[model samples]
Target: MNKSLAASVSPALYSSKTNTKIFTLTSAEHNIEVGNWKIDSTQLGILDTYFIIEQKILHGGKQEGSKIITLTSPNGLTITLSPTRGMSIINVIGQDMRFGWDSPVKEIVNPAFINLESRSGAGWLEGFNEMMVRCGFEWAGHPGLENGEMRTLHGKIGNTPASEVEIEINETAPYEIKIRGLIKESTFKKAELQTLAELSYTPGTHHFTIHDSLTNHADYPRDYQIMYHSNFSKPLLEKDAQFVAPIKEISPFNDYAQKGLSDWSAYLGPTKDFDEMVFNIVPFSKTDGSTIAALHNKDGSKGAAIEFNVKELPYLTLWKNTDTEKQGYVTGIEPGTNYAYAASIEREQGRIRQVKPGKTVHFKIKYSALMNKEAVNKVKKEITDIQGNQKTTIIQKPIAKE
Candidate 1:
């Protein structure tokens, strides 16, 4: 048990009565591995007893060697994180609702068994059962060739394991719990990129935030793209479910999507052999550049939403795959620096972002579980206010160079 005092609390915010603790679950450099650990206020002299942080490793089939961290918040929100899979969130259970989809891939397949380049570069699908999975550090989009190199689907970050993971407790009033991981993607003479992924939540709240800082460790500049594929299904995603956002522009991603242009924002019941439809959107942001997108059930009573800074993530991708439940019926509300086109096409469209040597870019997003009509209505009003009087530009076809 290699526990240490964390210095995250500022002097002004630090209280003599509180004890801030940091638990190192996995750190190769520090030679620490506190396996199957759990902590609560009872062990820290804190008043909040409802919160718990637990870490364990799965040991069977493809999930073997995968490290899982479960954070049970005071508000009854439980988030399951997979450090072995780029710290992707596997489940968000709260408010008597589960926010993730039921994917055919039942196991949280460790990166060791995942072949990101298999199945025509779509092997990432084999381990894609997560509420939210990141799609890039180098390139994030459809699989395609770039300069004769095949860029696999959604890049390799999600399949890359985190080298270090730790749990930090804020001790002061609010008592925030944070799980941080260091994920890196690098190749000799090609690119060197890393991101400090942090997921934090205050006690007694239905909301949690993901704050990630990505840095280019290469001596030269590197191009990058990232998309947060936040997914939802059944209970929160029923037939006629509405994908709501304050849109500045919207367009179909391809001919298949164009056929569903009129019903793009509306979801359908799971059908046999239903192909997915993708839409590209530029969301309207508030004056400070903050924006939100939400998916509500048919009656708008139950929902889930994501808030992000549009300046950092300037695009939204709506992915509707209403296939039969057995085939994985789900939808994705993705926010990213670019649309999910092939990297080459995005580069031609001037959407691929870049970072200089030793420079880091920051991205922050908040995920909320809307438990009732009141909560869902509040978000709807926020989006309505952002829309003001602007008319959304709807394009019937893909705009990028495909």
Candidate 2:
């Protein structure tokens, strides 16, 4: 560990063992706050290494009081997660590449400063700058009136703060690091949902996995939805970039998107005032229900891929927003339990998911950063194999619910 990474701490607050170590950064119930701390091989009494975990609190502007946890892996991969914002991953950087787009909103913007119900239900965009953010736990979709109540865009989970956060490390070789966060959304006479979100990363790797378990604490059955909005931009996303996936069926989400059906899988350079387009797709999966999706540059030398279980996330949404660079040029590869329609429309379409009393639902996704041609080719091949002998149906208009 680097000497400059050490922080002054009281031994009584944490364990001094050389094996696995657990740190409780914040727990309101336990009244604990290991404010602004860092740990590495030096503190663990092990061999010198670059692996380190640090937690810091931001103070200033709309980001005041936000808690950020950063994990620096030995393989030159670093990721920053915001526990203050539903444990969303804000940024990811590898030796020669970076994930995530440059959003107009520059600050991490603490949940306290965000108004999810403002702007006629589109206020969620005010604090949206994460590389990966979960959109649901209640309802995630377009803003509209559902049973006389305004359903905000993407729901409130993205703006909800985590009640507790913990960090754990493995004792043996590979030394995997896991960051866990607990977020709960409850309303009297409405619903109660608790989600345990965990992100795991191993040393010497350009990949990480996210595992989320959501349980209904309500006494009666509850309806819920979730979407993993993973966004990317330049380097991995640019002119001539291609989105590779084993498409089983696909259709435009609206009339606007229908105009770009011919070039749906290809991206364009940043254009002034570009109209965003969205495509809804059903991807082909392997016999075991696993699927892969990748976004690669023109020559396929640089890319990013996501592997997931189709049984967990049945639908995929492709979002293309190629507006001017300063106005936010980005694309989203989203997987969710349901489509990106209004909650009421999805319910009418029988796509809304439900959780029985005390029952839990699980979701797992793996993200890999491809920095070389070999890695990019490997993922493309996996997608091709899954697509074998399958005829992709391209519908001309938005899919109509039966």
lDDT of each: 0.87, 0.87
Model 2 TM: 0.94
Q: Write the per-residue lDDT of candidate 2 for residues 161-235, one digit (tens) a residue.
A: 887777777767777888888888989998899888899998778999999989899899999999899999988
Worst 10 residues of 2 by lDDT: 1-10
- Model 1: per-residue Cα lDDT over 52-126, one tens digit each: 888888999999988889988756699998999999999999867788999999998999998888998899999
lDDT for position 109 in model 2:
95
Stretches > 4 Å off in candidate 2 = 1-19, 400-402
Misplaced by over 4 Å in model 1 are 1-18
Q: For model 1, which pairs clash? A: none
